[model samples]
Target: MGLKYKYESTSRRDTKELARNVRPGDRLYVIHDVSQVVAPLEDAQLYSEFIVTKDKAPFTGTPMVCSASAHRQVGGTSVTSLLVRYGEVYTERPVGIRNIAEEPPLLPEFQHLAARVAREHAADVAVARSEAASSGRRRWF
Candidate 1:
């Protein structure tokens, strides 16, 4: 099973209520797969020129907005309710794209990177064992 970190929405809807309702250790499945139509960024020309011209752009590089909806699952199958976690909110204008990379890092990606390193180490050990077996040498582990 794939593991994912939970992100709570700042919306004042019932989903936020559910998050608040759940007790610590209560099993909760986060369902995040709903598509809402958003305006394409490529079609946005009003602020594009300024962003391209300015050295220190204030706006987010993404022209298209994304509407992210979240849901809570009580059991393995049932969706308890829906909530709006992230709306298509725009960032401050005129900001450069580089600024996004400079922002604080996400914890989930860091954990994933560490896990990948561990898997690589394990694979290396397995390869060494296979080589030792073929060469008539005892494997040291």
Candidate 2:
């Protein structure tokens, strides 16, 4: 058994409704384009597919669009559904899919947090060393 879901087309409300109430034997691949295709009852597997296009403005240094990094839980013996959860911007360069290291810095005072962290870590090490010296050397049993 698996978790059932509600999916949607970013442009259409009717297709969104279709996704929410889809049956086990439903052909959901291109429901966004043609919203009324049903699956053959004889067929045990179901099919669904979705695409999320997020294009950013052009850049000079690095290519931004890294991964459409998606999972294909879709299979022949199983039902397939693709729900595109993206930035939803149509552009020449798709800006979707980013890693955690690519995240922008926090706002305002927290922007310099990395430097502060390094300083704090240095202070902690110094404090630990001083305490150890004062406590005297330990003799291993």
Candidate 3:
């Protein structure tokens, strides 16, 4: 079995060449203006808060700070091309890797707030799971 690729333009050969030339550790930046996007995975998390930083440091000399971009230890060049379709740029310099520390202590107020948020989310998930189970849908839990 082979992975399928969707061509973005008439130049399918050129696109294939571009994907072939991509290598591991090739740094890329998201250029898509996500100002209007509401999804957290792409907007609040990946492009804005997670993708551009590791261990609290920026990938390079850039202004915007993003987080949670690297969902895995290794990503493919195909992902880079996919992002390019949405206006991202590949950098010549390889991305620097850093070690992330375990969760540190927070202020008492913050801890309380975190606990509340966790409880609320758990309740929401439980409700959703119950609804799904009753409806004979797939059990997400």
Write one digit per residue (lDDT tens) for candidate 3, span 1-141. Answer: 222223233465534543444343334343334343563323321222123222221342122223235556432224334444544333332133221322334657688899999999999999999899899997765
Question: lDDT value for candidate 2?
Answer: 0.35
In model 3, the Cα lDDT at residue 68 comes to: 35
Q: How do the candidates rank by TM-score, highest first?
A: 3, 2, 1
Per-model TM-score, in order, reads: 0.24, 0.27, 0.29
Residue-level lDDT of model 2, residues 1-141, one tens digit each, is: 222233344546533444334433233232211233462222232222323222222332111122222353223221112334331222222223222223443557665897799899899878777777789964332
Q: Which regions of candidate 3 are displaced past 4 Å?
A: 1-100, 139-141
Query: What is the Cα-based TM-score of model 2?
Result: 0.27
Tell me how far the alpha carbon of residue 76 in candidate 1 is from the true structure, in angstroms, after superposition. Answer: 50
Clashes of 3: 6
Q: Is candidate 2 or candidate 3 better by TM-score?
A: 3
Per-model CA lDDT versus the true structure:
0.35, 0.35, 0.41
Name the weakest run of 10 consecutive residues (lDDT summed) in model 3: 48-57
